[model samples]
Target: MSAEASVAAANFVTAARSFVGVPWRHLGRARTGLDCIGLVLLAAREAGVDLPDPAPYAREPQGTRLLEGILGHARRVAEAAPGDVLLFRLGLYGGHVGIASVHPAWGVPACLHAYAPRRQVVEQPMDDELRAALLGVFRLPALET
Candidate 1:
Protein backbone atom coordinates (compact mmCIF):
# COMPACT_ATOMS: atom_id res chain seq x y z
CA MET A 1 0.00 0.00 0.00
CA SER A 2 1.13 3.55 -0.58
CA ALA A 3 1.96 5.71 2.43
CA GLU A 4 -1.35 7.53 2.12
CA ALA A 5 -3.29 4.28 1.74
CA SER A 6 -1.55 2.80 4.78
CA VAL A 7 -2.50 5.78 6.91
CA ALA A 8 -6.08 5.63 5.65
CA ALA A 9 -6.33 1.94 6.50
CA ALA A 10 -5.00 2.52 10.00
CA ASN A 11 -7.42 5.37 10.53
CA PHE A 12 -10.32 3.30 9.18
CA VAL A 13 -9.54 0.40 11.48
CA THR A 14 -9.35 2.71 14.47
CA ALA A 15 -12.65 4.32 13.54
CA ALA A 16 -14.33 0.93 13.10
CA ARG A 17 -13.10 -0.30 16.48
CA SER A 18 -14.66 2.72 18.13
CA PHE A 19 -18.10 1.45 17.13
CA VAL A 20 -17.80 -1.76 19.09
CA GLY A 21 -20.64 -2.28 21.56
CA VAL A 22 -22.96 0.08 19.73
CA PRO A 23 -26.48 -1.26 19.45
CA TRP A 24 -27.82 -2.48 16.12
CA ARG A 25 -30.56 -0.51 14.42
CA HIS A 26 -31.73 -1.05 10.90
CA LEU A 27 -30.65 1.84 8.66
CA GLY A 28 -29.09 3.53 11.67
CA ARG A 29 -26.07 5.80 11.31
CA ALA A 30 -25.50 7.25 14.78
CA ARG A 31 -23.30 6.17 17.67
CA THR A 32 -26.32 4.98 19.61
CA GLY A 33 -27.17 2.47 16.91
CA LEU A 34 -25.97 1.35 13.50
CA ASP A 35 -26.40 -1.24 10.79
CA CYS A 36 -23.61 -2.80 8.75
CA ILE A 37 -23.79 -0.08 6.09
CA GLY A 38 -23.96 2.59 8.74
CA LEU A 39 -20.85 1.23 10.45
CA VAL A 40 -18.96 1.33 7.15
CA LEU A 41 -20.19 4.82 6.37
CA LEU A 42 -19.29 6.24 9.76
CA ALA A 43 -15.91 4.57 9.87
CA ALA A 44 -14.99 5.74 6.39
CA ARG A 45 -16.11 9.25 7.27
CA GLU A 46 -13.98 9.23 10.39
CA ALA A 47 -11.04 7.93 8.37
CA GLY A 48 -11.35 10.86 5.95
CA VAL A 49 -12.60 8.56 3.21
CA ASP A 50 -15.66 9.87 1.43
CA LEU A 51 -18.41 7.24 0.96
CA PRO A 52 -21.93 7.87 -0.22
CA ASP A 53 -24.67 6.93 2.18
CA PRO A 54 -26.96 4.55 0.32
CA ALA A 55 -29.63 4.68 2.90
CA PRO A 56 -33.39 4.22 2.54
CA TYR A 57 -32.61 0.70 1.49
CA ALA A 58 -34.60 -2.30 2.46
CA ARG A 59 -33.50 -4.40 5.42
CA GLU A 60 -33.10 -7.28 2.98
CA PRO A 61 -31.94 -5.57 -0.16
CA GLN A 62 -31.43 -7.36 -3.46
CA GLY A 63 -27.88 -8.56 -3.96
CA THR A 64 -27.54 -6.91 -7.36
CA ARG A 65 -28.68 -3.56 -6.08
CA LEU A 66 -26.33 -3.72 -3.14
CA LEU A 67 -23.39 -4.72 -5.30
CA GLU A 68 -24.16 -2.03 -7.84
CA GLY A 69 -24.28 0.65 -5.17
CA ILE A 70 -20.91 -0.41 -3.80
CA LEU A 71 -19.33 -0.79 -7.23
CA GLY A 72 -20.36 2.75 -8.05
CA HIS A 73 -18.14 4.04 -5.25
CA ALA A 74 -15.38 1.49 -4.63
CA ARG A 75 -13.22 -0.80 -6.65
CA ARG A 76 -13.07 -4.54 -6.28
CA VAL A 77 -9.91 -5.93 -4.69
CA ALA A 78 -8.39 -9.41 -4.85
CA GLU A 79 -7.76 -9.58 -1.14
CA ALA A 80 -9.11 -7.75 1.83
CA ALA A 81 -6.75 -5.61 3.91
CA PRO A 82 -7.54 -3.80 7.09
CA GLY A 83 -10.08 -1.06 6.23
CA ASP A 84 -11.31 -2.80 3.11
CA VAL A 85 -15.02 -3.49 2.88
CA LEU A 86 -16.17 -7.10 2.74
CA LEU A 87 -19.30 -8.10 0.92
CA PHE A 88 -20.78 -11.38 2.10
CA ARG A 89 -23.40 -13.68 0.63
CA LEU A 90 -25.56 -14.41 3.61
CA GLY A 91 -27.52 -17.37 2.36
CA LEU A 92 -30.05 -16.33 -0.29
CA TYR A 93 -30.05 -12.59 0.40
CA GLY A 94 -26.32 -11.82 0.19
CA GLY A 95 -26.36 -8.19 1.30
CA HIS A 96 -24.19 -8.17 4.38
CA VAL A 97 -21.19 -5.84 4.63
CA GLY A 98 -18.36 -5.31 7.13
CA ILE A 99 -15.02 -3.68 7.64
CA ALA A 100 -11.96 -5.91 7.62
CA SER A 101 -9.70 -5.76 10.64
CA VAL A 102 -7.25 -7.80 12.67
CA HIS A 103 -8.50 -9.79 15.58
CA PRO A 104 -6.96 -8.24 18.67
CA ALA A 105 -6.54 -11.49 20.59
CA TRP A 106 -5.95 -13.95 17.77
CA GLY A 107 -3.75 -11.70 15.67
CA VAL A 108 -5.66 -13.01 12.67
CA PRO A 109 -7.98 -11.50 10.10
CA ALA A 110 -11.35 -10.47 11.47
CA CYS A 111 -14.32 -8.32 10.59
CA LEU A 112 -15.98 -5.50 12.46
CA HIS A 113 -19.69 -5.18 11.77
CA ALA A 114 -23.05 -4.29 13.16
CA TYR A 115 -24.64 -7.71 13.50
CA ALA A 116 -28.40 -7.73 13.71
CA PRO A 117 -28.66 -11.13 15.35
CA ARG A 118 -26.09 -10.16 17.97
CA ARG A 119 -27.84 -6.77 18.21
CA GLN A 120 -24.56 -4.88 18.50
CA VAL A 121 -21.30 -4.12 16.83
CA VAL A 122 -18.72 -6.91 17.05
CA GLU A 123 -15.33 -7.99 15.83
CA GLN A 124 -15.32 -11.64 14.89
CA PRO A 125 -12.62 -13.79 13.38
CA MET A 126 -13.02 -14.29 9.65
CA ASP A 127 -13.53 -18.02 9.87
CA ASP A 128 -14.38 -20.57 7.21
CA GLU A 129 -18.09 -19.83 7.20
CA LEU A 130 -17.50 -16.16 6.56
CA ARG A 131 -14.84 -16.89 3.99
CA ALA A 132 -17.17 -19.19 2.13
CA ALA A 133 -19.84 -16.52 2.08
CA LEU A 134 -17.56 -13.73 0.91
CA LEU A 135 -18.75 -12.37 -2.41
CA GLY A 136 -16.19 -9.61 -2.86
CA VAL A 137 -13.63 -7.34 -1.23
CA PHE A 138 -13.62 -3.65 -2.01
CA ARG A 139 -11.30 -0.69 -1.43
CA LEU A 140 -12.51 2.87 -1.29
CA PRO A 141 -11.14 5.38 -3.79
CA ALA A 142 -9.32 7.28 -1.07
CA LEU A 143 -7.42 4.15 -0.14
CA GLU A 144 -6.31 3.56 -3.72
CA THR A 145 -2.81 4.42 -4.89
Candidate 2:
Protein backbone atom coordinates (compact mmCIF):
# COMPACT_ATOMS: atom_id res chain seq x y z
CA MET A 1 0.00 0.00 0.00
CA SER A 2 1.07 3.54 -0.56
CA ALA A 3 1.77 5.72 2.47
CA GLU A 4 -1.55 7.57 1.98
CA ALA A 5 -3.42 4.31 1.62
CA SER A 6 -1.82 2.93 4.78
CA VAL A 7 -2.88 5.94 6.79
CA ALA A 8 -6.41 5.73 5.41
CA ALA A 9 -6.58 2.03 6.25
CA ALA A 10 -5.55 2.67 9.82
CA ASN A 11 -8.21 5.34 10.22
CA PHE A 12 -10.88 3.17 8.65
CA VAL A 13 -9.97 0.15 10.77
CA THR A 14 -10.09 2.20 13.93
CA ALA A 15 -13.56 3.48 13.03
CA ALA A 16 -14.81 -0.01 12.19
CA ARG A 17 -13.52 -1.42 15.48
CA SER A 18 -15.64 1.10 17.32
CA PHE A 19 -18.77 -0.66 16.04
CA VAL A 20 -17.82 -4.14 17.21
CA GLY A 21 -20.68 -4.58 19.68
CA VAL A 22 -23.52 -2.90 17.81
CA PRO A 23 -26.63 -5.02 17.38
CA TRP A 24 -27.59 -6.08 13.89
CA ARG A 25 -30.65 -4.56 12.27
CA HIS A 26 -31.95 -4.50 8.76
CA LEU A 27 -31.05 -1.23 7.02
CA GLY A 28 -29.67 0.16 10.27
CA ARG A 29 -27.05 2.92 10.07
CA ALA A 30 -26.23 3.92 13.62
CA ARG A 31 -24.16 2.88 16.61
CA THR A 32 -27.17 1.19 18.27
CA GLY A 33 -27.68 -1.07 15.29
CA LEU A 34 -26.26 -1.67 11.83
CA ASP A 35 -26.41 -4.05 8.92
CA CYS A 36 -23.28 -5.00 7.01
CA ILE A 37 -23.57 -2.16 4.50
CA GLY A 38 -24.53 0.22 7.27
CA LEU A 39 -21.42 -0.71 9.19
CA VAL A 40 -19.35 0.02 6.11
CA LEU A 41 -21.16 3.28 5.43
CA LEU A 42 -20.80 4.67 8.91
CA ALA A 43 -17.24 3.54 9.30
CA ALA A 44 -16.31 5.23 6.05
CA ARG A 45 -17.84 8.44 7.31
CA GLU A 46 -15.92 8.24 10.54
CA ALA A 47 -12.77 7.63 8.56
CA GLY A 48 -13.41 10.84 6.58
CA VAL A 49 -14.76 9.15 3.49
CA ASP A 50 -18.25 10.31 2.62
CA LEU A 51 -20.20 7.46 1.08
CA PRO A 52 -23.71 7.91 -0.14
CA ASP A 53 -26.37 5.66 1.31
CA PRO A 54 -26.92 2.45 -0.61
CA ALA A 55 -30.42 1.83 0.57
CA PRO A 56 -33.61 0.49 -0.99
CA TYR A 57 -32.11 -2.93 -0.46
CA ALA A 58 -33.64 -6.09 0.83
CA ARG A 59 -32.48 -7.79 3.98
CA GLU A 60 -30.94 -10.35 1.64
CA PRO A 61 -30.09 -8.58 -1.54
CA GLN A 62 -29.39 -10.63 -4.64
CA GLY A 63 -25.75 -11.13 -5.52
CA THR A 64 -25.91 -8.91 -8.57
CA ARG A 65 -27.53 -6.07 -6.70
CA LEU A 66 -24.99 -6.27 -3.93
CA LEU A 67 -22.18 -6.27 -6.44
CA GLU A 68 -23.71 -3.32 -8.23
CA GLY A 69 -23.89 -1.36 -5.03
CA ILE A 70 -20.28 -2.06 -4.29
CA LEU A 71 -19.15 -1.22 -7.79
CA GLY A 72 -20.97 2.07 -7.63
CA HIS A 73 -18.50 3.31 -5.07
CA ALA A 74 -15.50 1.01 -5.00
CA ARG A 75 -13.21 -0.58 -7.49
CA ARG A 76 -12.58 -4.31 -7.40
CA VAL A 77 -9.12 -5.28 -6.30
CA ALA A 78 -7.00 -8.45 -6.40
CA GLU A 79 -6.03 -8.55 -2.73
CA ALA A 80 -7.55 -7.53 0.57
CA ALA A 81 -5.69 -5.29 2.97
CA PRO A 82 -7.01 -3.68 6.12
CA GLY A 83 -9.88 -1.28 5.28
CA ASP A 84 -10.69 -2.94 2.00
CA VAL A 85 -14.24 -4.11 1.41
CA LEU A 86 -14.61 -7.87 1.27
CA LEU A 87 -17.51 -9.45 -0.59
CA PHE A 88 -18.64 -12.97 0.12
CA ARG A 89 -21.29 -15.30 -1.20
CA LEU A 90 -23.85 -16.38 1.38
CA GLY A 91 -25.25 -19.43 -0.30
CA LEU A 92 -28.27 -18.84 -2.59
CA TYR A 93 -29.53 -15.98 -0.49
CA GLY A 94 -27.04 -13.74 -2.21
CA GLY A 95 -24.04 -12.04 -0.62
CA HIS A 96 -22.52 -10.34 2.35
CA VAL A 97 -20.06 -7.51 2.86
CA GLY A 98 -17.54 -6.57 5.52
CA ILE A 99 -14.52 -4.49 6.32
CA ALA A 100 -11.23 -6.33 6.20
CA SER A 101 -9.19 -6.07 9.36
CA VAL A 102 -6.64 -7.93 11.42
CA HIS A 103 -8.18 -10.15 14.05
CA PRO A 104 -7.62 -8.69 17.48
CA ALA A 105 -7.06 -12.05 19.14
CA TRP A 106 -5.40 -14.03 16.37
CA GLY A 107 -3.53 -11.18 14.73
CA VAL A 108 -4.52 -12.60 11.36
CA PRO A 109 -6.77 -11.45 8.56
CA ALA A 110 -10.36 -11.06 9.73
CA CYS A 111 -13.63 -9.39 8.82
CA LEU A 112 -15.52 -6.79 10.76
CA HIS A 113 -19.21 -6.94 10.01
CA ALA A 114 -22.73 -6.76 11.34
CA TYR A 115 -23.63 -10.42 11.14
CA ALA A 116 -27.33 -11.22 11.25
CA PRO A 117 -26.80 -14.74 12.55
CA ARG A 118 -24.59 -13.43 15.31
CA ARG A 119 -27.11 -10.56 15.80
CA GLN A 120 -24.30 -8.11 16.37
CA VAL A 121 -21.17 -6.65 14.90
CA VAL A 122 -18.16 -8.92 15.20
CA GLU A 123 -14.55 -9.21 14.14
CA GLN A 124 -13.84 -12.82 13.25
CA PRO A 125 -10.93 -14.54 11.62
CA MET A 126 -11.24 -15.16 7.90
CA ASP A 127 -11.09 -18.90 8.25
CA ASP A 128 -11.32 -21.43 5.42
CA GLU A 129 -15.08 -21.28 5.03
CA LEU A 130 -15.00 -17.50 4.70
CA ARG A 131 -12.11 -17.64 2.29
CA ALA A 132 -14.07 -20.07 0.17
CA ALA A 133 -17.04 -17.78 0.11
CA LEU A 134 -15.08 -14.69 -0.76
CA LEU A 135 -16.18 -13.35 -4.15
CA GLY A 136 -14.13 -10.18 -4.47
CA VAL A 137 -12.00 -7.57 -2.78
CA PHE A 138 -12.57 -3.83 -3.22
CA ARG A 139 -11.11 -0.53 -2.15
CA LEU A 140 -12.75 2.85 -1.91
CA PRO A 141 -11.34 5.42 -4.32
CA ALA A 142 -10.95 7.99 -1.58
CA LEU A 143 -8.67 5.68 0.34
CA GLU A 144 -6.22 5.44 -2.52
CA THR A 145 -3.66 7.91 -3.87
Candidate 3:
Protein backbone atom coordinates (compact mmCIF):
# COMPACT_ATOMS: atom_id res chain seq x y z
CA MET A 1 0.00 0.00 0.00
CA SER A 2 1.16 3.50 -0.74
CA ALA A 3 1.41 6.18 1.88
CA GLU A 4 -2.02 7.46 0.95
CA ALA A 5 -3.49 3.98 1.17
CA SER A 6 -1.87 3.40 4.51
CA VAL A 7 -3.22 6.68 5.75
CA ALA A 8 -6.69 5.85 4.52
CA ALA A 9 -6.69 2.51 6.29
CA ALA A 10 -5.36 4.13 9.41
CA ASN A 11 -8.11 6.71 9.35
CA PHE A 12 -10.76 4.05 9.01
CA VAL A 13 -9.28 2.00 11.80
CA THR A 14 -8.98 4.96 14.07
CA ALA A 15 -12.57 5.96 13.53
CA ALA A 16 -13.90 2.47 14.00
CA ARG A 17 -11.76 1.72 17.03
CA SER A 18 -13.33 4.70 18.74
CA PHE A 19 -16.48 2.67 19.24
CA VAL A 20 -14.70 0.07 21.31
CA GLY A 21 -16.11 -0.54 24.81
CA VAL A 22 -19.53 0.83 23.93
CA PRO A 23 -22.51 -1.01 25.31
CA TRP A 24 -24.29 -3.33 22.84
CA ARG A 25 -27.49 -1.81 21.56
CA HIS A 26 -29.57 -3.32 18.81
CA LEU A 27 -30.31 -1.06 15.84
CA GLY A 28 -28.38 1.64 17.61
CA ARG A 29 -26.55 4.26 15.52
CA ALA A 30 -24.83 6.51 18.02
CA ARG A 31 -21.07 6.68 17.70
CA THR A 32 -20.71 5.77 21.36
CA GLY A 33 -23.21 2.94 20.97
CA LEU A 34 -23.62 0.49 18.11
CA ASP A 35 -24.52 -3.05 17.23
CA CYS A 36 -22.50 -5.32 14.98
CA ILE A 37 -24.40 -4.24 11.88
CA GLY A 38 -24.33 -0.63 12.96
CA LEU A 39 -20.60 -0.75 13.52
CA VAL A 40 -19.97 -2.34 10.15
CA LEU A 41 -22.01 0.33 8.44
CA LEU A 42 -20.31 3.11 10.34
CA ALA A 43 -16.82 1.84 9.59
CA ALA A 44 -17.57 1.38 5.92
CA ARG A 45 -18.97 4.87 5.66
CA GLU A 46 -15.98 6.32 7.47
CA ALA A 47 -13.69 4.52 5.04
CA GLY A 48 -15.60 6.27 2.25
CA VAL A 49 -17.26 3.05 1.19
CA ASP A 50 -21.01 2.65 0.69
CA LEU A 51 -23.16 -0.26 1.83
CA PRO A 52 -26.75 -1.34 1.66
CA ASP A 53 -29.26 0.00 4.15
CA PRO A 54 -33.06 0.06 4.63
CA ALA A 55 -33.24 -3.63 3.80
CA PRO A 56 -35.32 -5.53 6.28
CA TYR A 57 -33.86 -8.00 8.74
CA ALA A 58 -35.90 -11.02 9.62
CA ARG A 59 -37.31 -11.61 13.07
CA GLU A 60 -34.84 -14.46 13.09
CA PRO A 61 -32.09 -15.29 10.64
CA GLN A 62 -32.93 -18.13 8.31
CA GLY A 63 -30.76 -21.11 7.31
CA THR A 64 -28.64 -18.86 5.10
CA ARG A 65 -28.30 -15.29 3.78
CA LEU A 66 -29.08 -13.83 7.18
CA LEU A 67 -29.02 -10.27 5.87
CA GLU A 68 -31.04 -9.37 2.83
CA GLY A 69 -29.00 -6.40 1.66
CA ILE A 70 -25.80 -8.40 1.71
CA LEU A 71 -27.51 -10.96 -0.43
CA GLY A 72 -28.60 -8.54 -3.16
CA HIS A 73 -26.40 -5.47 -2.96
CA ALA A 74 -22.81 -6.37 -2.00
CA ARG A 75 -21.39 -8.26 -4.96
CA ARG A 76 -19.75 -11.54 -4.01
CA VAL A 77 -16.60 -12.84 -5.70
CA ALA A 78 -13.54 -15.03 -5.01
CA GLU A 79 -10.74 -12.58 -5.76
CA ALA A 80 -8.79 -11.26 -2.74
CA ALA A 81 -7.65 -7.68 -2.45
CA PRO A 82 -7.30 -4.92 0.12
CA GLY A 83 -10.43 -3.34 1.61
CA ASP A 84 -12.63 -6.27 0.70
CA VAL A 85 -15.90 -6.99 2.51
CA LEU A 86 -15.97 -10.25 4.45
CA LEU A 87 -18.91 -12.38 5.54
CA PHE A 88 -18.39 -15.13 8.11
CA ARG A 89 -20.56 -18.19 8.18
CA LEU A 90 -20.94 -19.12 11.81
CA GLY A 91 -23.68 -21.63 11.15
CA LEU A 92 -26.91 -22.10 9.22
CA TYR A 93 -27.94 -18.67 10.42
CA GLY A 94 -25.26 -17.20 12.63
CA GLY A 95 -23.00 -15.03 10.48
CA HIS A 96 -20.86 -11.92 10.67
CA VAL A 97 -19.34 -9.38 8.31
CA GLY A 98 -16.41 -6.98 8.39
CA ILE A 99 -13.86 -5.25 6.19
CA ALA A 100 -10.57 -6.91 5.27
CA SER A 101 -8.07 -4.80 7.16
CA VAL A 102 -4.85 -6.75 6.55
CA HIS A 103 -3.54 -9.90 4.90
CA PRO A 104 -0.51 -12.30 4.87
CA ALA A 105 -0.13 -12.57 8.65
CA TRP A 106 1.87 -15.83 8.50
CA GLY A 107 -1.35 -17.59 9.43
CA VAL A 108 -4.82 -16.12 9.63
CA PRO A 109 -5.10 -12.53 8.46
CA ALA A 110 -6.77 -9.76 10.39
CA CYS A 111 -9.99 -7.81 9.84
CA LEU A 112 -11.82 -4.99 11.58
CA HIS A 113 -15.17 -6.08 12.93
CA ALA A 114 -17.95 -4.62 15.07
CA TYR A 115 -19.21 -7.43 17.22
CA ALA A 116 -22.51 -7.46 19.04
CA PRO A 117 -22.61 -7.31 22.86
CA ARG A 118 -19.31 -5.48 22.77
CA ARG A 119 -21.08 -2.74 20.81
CA GLN A 120 -17.69 -1.63 19.66
CA VAL A 121 -15.24 -2.04 16.83
CA VAL A 122 -12.43 -4.51 17.38
CA GLU A 123 -9.45 -5.77 15.46
CA GLN A 124 -10.06 -9.47 15.63
CA PRO A 125 -7.63 -11.99 14.18
CA MET A 126 -9.00 -14.12 11.42
CA ASP A 127 -8.03 -17.46 12.89
CA ASP A 128 -8.89 -20.99 11.71
CA GLU A 129 -12.42 -20.70 13.03
CA LEU A 130 -12.90 -17.47 11.11
CA ARG A 131 -11.32 -18.96 8.01
CA ALA A 132 -13.62 -21.93 8.16
CA ALA A 133 -16.62 -19.71 8.75
CA LEU A 134 -15.70 -17.30 5.97
CA LEU A 135 -18.57 -17.65 3.59
CA GLY A 136 -17.96 -14.65 1.35
CA VAL A 137 -15.47 -11.89 0.63
CA PHE A 138 -16.13 -9.00 -1.75
CA ARG A 139 -13.99 -6.23 -3.12
CA LEU A 140 -15.19 -2.74 -2.18
CA PRO A 141 -14.14 -1.29 -5.56
CA ALA A 142 -10.99 0.75 -5.32
CA LEU A 143 -11.10 4.45 -4.56
CA GLU A 144 -8.73 7.02 -6.04
CA THR A 145 -8.07 10.54 -4.88
Candidate 4:
Protein backbone atom coordinates (compact mmCIF):
# COMPACT_ATOMS: atom_id res chain seq x y z
CA MET A 1 0.00 0.00 0.00
CA SER A 2 1.06 3.59 -0.56
CA ALA A 3 2.14 5.60 2.45
CA GLU A 4 -1.13 7.54 2.69
CA ALA A 5 -3.22 4.39 2.37
CA SER A 6 -1.02 2.66 4.88
CA VAL A 7 -1.55 5.42 7.41
CA ALA A 8 -5.31 5.28 6.95
CA ALA A 9 -5.30 1.52 7.19
CA ALA A 10 -3.58 1.77 10.52
CA ASN A 11 -5.90 4.50 11.76
CA PHE A 12 -8.99 2.58 10.70
CA VAL A 13 -8.15 -0.24 13.08
CA THR A 14 -6.90 1.99 15.84
CA ALA A 15 -9.83 4.43 15.74
CA ALA A 16 -12.55 1.78 15.77
CA ARG A 17 -10.81 -0.30 18.42
CA SER A 18 -10.98 2.70 20.73
CA PHE A 19 -14.78 2.42 20.89
CA VAL A 20 -15.02 -1.01 22.47
CA GLY A 21 -17.26 -1.58 25.52
CA VAL A 22 -19.62 1.28 24.65
CA PRO A 23 -23.24 0.56 25.48
CA TRP A 24 -25.92 0.01 22.83
CA ARG A 25 -28.54 2.61 22.08
CA HIS A 26 -30.73 3.66 19.22
CA LEU A 27 -29.40 6.63 17.17
CA GLY A 28 -26.43 7.01 19.49
CA ARG A 29 -22.69 7.39 18.67
CA ALA A 30 -20.45 8.06 21.66
CA ARG A 31 -19.18 5.73 24.37
CA THR A 32 -22.18 6.76 26.42
CA GLY A 33 -24.34 7.40 23.37
CA LEU A 34 -24.24 5.59 20.02
CA ASP A 35 -26.51 3.47 17.91
CA CYS A 36 -25.28 0.96 15.31
CA ILE A 37 -25.25 3.33 12.36
CA GLY A 38 -23.76 6.14 14.38
CA LEU A 39 -20.96 3.96 15.53
CA VAL A 40 -20.15 2.93 11.98
CA LEU A 41 -20.19 6.48 10.63
CA LEU A 42 -18.31 7.80 13.61
CA ALA A 43 -15.48 5.32 13.31
CA ALA A 44 -15.19 5.82 9.58
CA ARG A 45 -15.11 9.59 9.80
CA GLU A 46 -12.69 9.51 12.68
CA ALA A 47 -10.47 7.16 10.76
CA GLY A 48 -10.64 9.42 7.67
CA VAL A 49 -12.71 7.09 5.51
CA ASP A 50 -14.95 8.92 3.06
CA LEU A 51 -18.66 7.98 3.11
CA PRO A 52 -22.05 9.54 3.07
CA ASP A 53 -23.70 10.53 6.29
CA PRO A 54 -26.77 8.60 7.37
CA ALA A 55 -29.78 9.82 5.47
CA PRO A 56 -33.27 10.38 6.77
CA TYR A 57 -35.41 7.25 6.99
CA ALA A 58 -38.29 8.70 5.03
CA ARG A 59 -36.06 9.68 2.13
CA GLU A 60 -34.81 6.11 1.76
CA PRO A 61 -36.82 3.02 0.97
CA GLN A 62 -37.44 0.41 3.59
CA GLY A 63 -37.67 -3.33 2.87
CA THR A 64 -34.49 -3.03 0.85
CA ARG A 65 -32.49 -6.09 1.83
CA LEU A 66 -29.15 -5.04 3.30
CA LEU A 67 -27.25 -7.37 1.06
CA GLU A 68 -28.97 -5.93 -1.96
CA GLY A 69 -28.56 -2.31 -0.93
CA ILE A 70 -24.93 -2.74 0.05
CA LEU A 71 -23.72 -4.79 -2.89
CA GLY A 72 -25.67 -2.53 -5.19
CA HIS A 73 -24.00 0.62 -3.87
CA ALA A 74 -20.63 -0.33 -2.38
CA ARG A 75 -17.62 -2.35 -3.46
CA ARG A 76 -17.52 -6.13 -3.09
CA VAL A 77 -16.61 -7.99 0.07
CA ALA A 78 -13.60 -9.70 -1.49
CA GLU A 79 -11.74 -6.39 -1.80
CA ALA A 80 -12.64 -5.20 1.70
CA ALA A 81 -9.92 -4.27 4.17
CA PRO A 82 -9.66 -2.60 7.53
CA GLY A 83 -11.93 0.51 7.55
CA ASP A 84 -14.02 -0.88 4.74
CA VAL A 85 -17.79 -0.69 4.94
CA LEU A 86 -19.64 -3.54 6.69
CA LEU A 87 -23.25 -4.51 6.16
CA PHE A 88 -25.25 -6.93 8.32
CA ARG A 89 -28.73 -7.67 9.59
CA LEU A 90 -29.75 -6.76 13.07
CA GLY A 91 -31.77 -8.88 15.51
CA LEU A 92 -34.65 -9.47 13.07
CA TYR A 93 -35.69 -6.71 10.71
CA GLY A 94 -32.99 -4.11 11.03
CA GLY A 95 -30.15 -4.07 8.52
CA HIS A 96 -27.11 -2.12 9.69
CA VAL A 97 -23.82 -0.75 8.36
CA GLY A 98 -20.47 0.13 9.92
CA ILE A 99 -16.84 0.64 9.09
CA ALA A 100 -15.01 -2.65 8.48
CA SER A 101 -12.44 -1.87 11.15
CA VAL A 102 -10.17 -4.19 13.13
CA HIS A 103 -9.47 -4.84 16.77
CA PRO A 104 -5.86 -5.41 17.73
CA ALA A 105 -6.81 -6.54 21.21
CA TRP A 106 -8.79 -9.47 19.87
CA GLY A 107 -5.88 -11.43 18.42
CA VAL A 108 -6.14 -9.18 15.33
CA PRO A 109 -9.24 -10.87 13.98
CA ALA A 110 -10.95 -9.27 10.97
CA CYS A 111 -14.05 -7.47 12.26
CA LEU A 112 -15.88 -4.26 11.51
CA HIS A 113 -18.79 -2.98 13.63
CA ALA A 114 -20.17 -0.51 16.12
CA TYR A 115 -22.49 -2.55 18.35
CA ALA A 116 -24.68 -0.14 20.34
CA PRO A 117 -26.45 -2.76 22.45
CA ARG A 118 -23.07 -3.45 23.95
CA ARG A 119 -21.98 0.17 23.68
CA GLN A 120 -19.07 1.19 21.32
CA VAL A 121 -17.47 -0.34 18.24
CA VAL A 122 -16.34 -3.90 18.95
CA GLU A 123 -14.41 -6.58 17.18
CA GLN A 124 -16.42 -9.76 16.89
CA PRO A 125 -15.46 -13.29 15.98
CA MET A 126 -15.44 -13.90 12.23
CA ASP A 127 -17.46 -17.03 12.73
CA ASP A 128 -20.24 -18.86 10.91
CA GLU A 129 -23.01 -16.72 12.35
CA LEU A 130 -21.42 -13.66 10.78
CA ARG A 131 -20.77 -15.52 7.55
CA ALA A 132 -24.43 -16.43 7.31
CA ALA A 133 -25.75 -12.95 8.09
CA LEU A 134 -23.26 -10.63 6.46
CA LEU A 135 -24.66 -9.07 3.31
CA GLY A 136 -21.40 -7.51 2.16
CA VAL A 137 -18.10 -6.17 3.40
CA PHE A 138 -16.57 -3.42 1.26
CA ARG A 139 -13.79 -0.87 1.29
CA LEU A 140 -14.07 2.74 0.15
CA PRO A 141 -14.53 3.14 -3.58
CA ALA A 142 -11.80 5.78 -3.72
CA LEU A 143 -9.36 3.43 -2.00
CA GLU A 144 -9.89 0.89 -4.75
CA THR A 145 -8.08 3.20 -7.17
Candidate with best TM-score: 1
In lDDT terms, how accurate is model 3?
0.60
TM-score of 1: 0.93
Off by over 4 Å in 3: 1-14, 55-60, 63-66, 103-108, 117-119, 142-145
Off by over 4 Å in 1: none
Candidate 2 lDDT: 0.87
**Tens digits of lDDT, candidate 4, 19-71:** 76776666665678665566666666787665554544421236544234333
Candidate 2: which pairs clash?
none
Please provide TM-scores, in order, for all candidate models, with all chains considered together: 0.93, 0.92, 0.68, 0.71
Instruction: List model 3 lDDT by residue over 47-97, tens digit each.
Output: 776667633455345654545554445556784344556777645654566
- Is candidate 1 or 3 superior in TM-score? 1
Model 4 quality (TM-score): 0.71
Lowest-sum lDDT 10-residue window in model 3: 136-145
Model 1: per-residue Cα lDDT over 69-109, one tens digit each: 55577888899999899988866866889999999899999
lDDT of 2 by residue, 5-122 (tens): 8999889989999999999999898998999889988998999988777686877666557556555778889989999999888777436889999998889999999999999999
Clashing pairs in 1: none
